[model samples]
Target: MKKISILVTAILALVFNACSTDDEFTFVAKPDPEGIAFMNTFLPSYILKPSNATNLAERFVWNEVDMDVQTTVRYELQASADESFQNMTVIESDIATTNQAVTVGELLALAEEAGLDTDPDTEASNSGTVYFQVRAYAGENPATTVEQFSEPVGITVELVEDTSGEVELPKIYVVGNFQGAGGYGSDWTPADGVPLAASGPAKTDYEGFVYLNVDKPQFKFLPTNASFDGDYGDAGETDGVFTGKLKQEGEKNAGTPDGTGGYYWFKVDTEKMTYSLTKVDWGLIGNATPTGWDSDTDLVYNPETKLWTLTLELTEQVAPDNGIKFRANDGWDINLGDTGADGTLEFGGDNIGVPESGNYTVTMDLSNPRDYTYTLVKN
Candidate 1:
């Protein structure tokens, strides 16, 4: 009887395993007909100006999309010169989030591509409309039928006629609790804050390096050096945004520091309305230095001058293959190089030319935002 029972149990287990394989399910997402909609409050019209080119054209937010079956949704944001979206340019692709930020500079590029000109002297209309659309789809390479595209939304962009050759680089000031450490003045004082340089002519993005002495130090962003009239606190989400209040009023976005802070890369995006602080240590690496492309030499930071300094010997280097770049934390994730060989540093730019093989005092000045520069002074 015992032998028979054992044989029966084995048979039952085998049958259950076969049934489970037969019931295997593969979830395929179906395109939702309702589609996605823009949730942002549209401006009457976008009057673009070179002076405020860095400002955000708009922060296009939308509700979460649906794909019927349970699966991950990928989004793509696009802009076109016409309502038909025949000649469209992708702004963001494969985004899991439901929001996208467009900058004036970005729009200017689109307008230029659309054959629209800001120069009133020309025949092209100074004012025109740009259409935007959002696409949601699934699977790595989804079929056309599985893609859900939103209805085209038009935004009017008027080019402000200007020949002044004036383009204001947008600036965002930082006021934090670790003020005295890096000559940042009194803690939490907007009037004594440091400026985070705009990434370029675009004012929506800003970046800079700062030293924070305290652990978990707190900070805030100010638009000007006068008062906290137009300031930003943490927006509650990670990698922060402006919540429109101050910490004194118990505003939660007091600023999230990288706990054990020393030297950090501070970045802010007004279009995205977010701020971030990344701790880093600056180093020099390249085939120009002693270690070639394998290692990095340390660079010292001065609080008073807010510059990175290093005095070392460099080898004579020829272009296209050999040279140096300023990288952080001994990694290639963040690095700066001279693209134009014009003393200005551009992120992931080309290699800088060695003024020849000799001992020189290298000075890296990132203190002034948007104007990153380096100097090689022979001893």
Candidate 2:
């Protein structure tokens, strides 16, 4: 019986040893605290409030995450006029919060307490440009571990004019769209010489205007003379002299000899001060049709109008027959007027004028018949 007991015990010992040897264990490596994984920790995207206002404060909010271990988070908001964020002034720094998540309004209030502007409803005392950015911290070592930084946002405060004792003149000139003139030809010279005293009688046209400043009665061109060729006579009159005079304030008529090559010239005198001259072809004004027509297409300066009228003719019959369309650089649809006979359409709008001095495109739909494009530019 004792021998048998010993054998059973030996078998039990062998079984225990086999079980121990067959059992396997595994372990996961701990994340490196000072490695790139620490620097690449995830953070929430941020948004700013009062995006369009001059006097505005910033606010922020973040996503919430739950972990088995307790974690601490702090925030630092920085601002500067530059994008690099170097030497940025700290708007709010080391804002302590134990909460895993916070609302944007609460964050803004906290920022206010930390000496940030806070009052987005309030107007700025002065007008200028401002930029902003923010950095978030996770873990106990808030000083060195920044989870992420937000993209910068910028705002410009426009300056208000104080038009008290000052006289406001027309901001721009409308000089094209002449009635009895052709393309004004490709090569013409702009007349340049000393202003002749109101010779004989003063003349006037829809194209030119005079400004009388009493102290400086002079005429300035919308675009400088350097913009156009220096020729001012009939198309063929390379030698004929064109003459006109400035009578009063806004009157001046210069005559051009009648001919295919006849051109015209005039001078602007400002008592003793400096002045300039500008010219525009009348035929080049107004909106063009799908005929590929364009104003200033010849590289000439054409006056712009707050109102533009376009005429479209459709010779083909198609459902929703493609037509010309005008769009701002921002891709906003401009107003298109009514359609006349045979797909003829018109478009007009106020404040539809180009806001800046640059090149603009007018698109024509070639999917239909007689389709083309025209481009206009302002100098």
1-379, model 1: which lDDT tens digit per residue? 0000000000000000111357675555654555567777677667776555545678877767666555567777877765656777777777788887777777766666566665646777766666677777665642322566655455667777656655456676888778877688888787778888675443467788778767676677776667775567775554233343333223454544435658878887756766677788888888888888999999999988888999999988865467888998999898999886889998898887785999978899987777889998888
Please give each candidate's TM-score. 0.58, 0.20
- The C-alpha lDDT values of all candidates are 0.69, 0.27
1-379 per-residue lDDT for model 2 (tens digits): 0000000000000001111345653222222232211112222222322211111222333332222123444555555433444544554555553212222322332223223342334443223333344444544432433254333334332222222532221111212222213222111222321112222111111122221112211222222223322112212222222233222223332223221121122243322222233222212222332242232222222222212223333222212333233432212232222243232323332212223333344322211111112333332
Top lDDT model? 1
**What does the lDDT come to for candidate 1?**
0.69
Error of 1 at 146 (Å): 34
Q: Clash number for every model?
A: 4, 20
TM-score of 1: 0.58
**Candidate 1 regions with alpha-carbon error over 4 angstroms:** 1-166, 199-203, 236-250
In angstroms, how far off is 170's CA in candidate 2?
A: 36
**CA lDDT for candidate 2:** 0.27
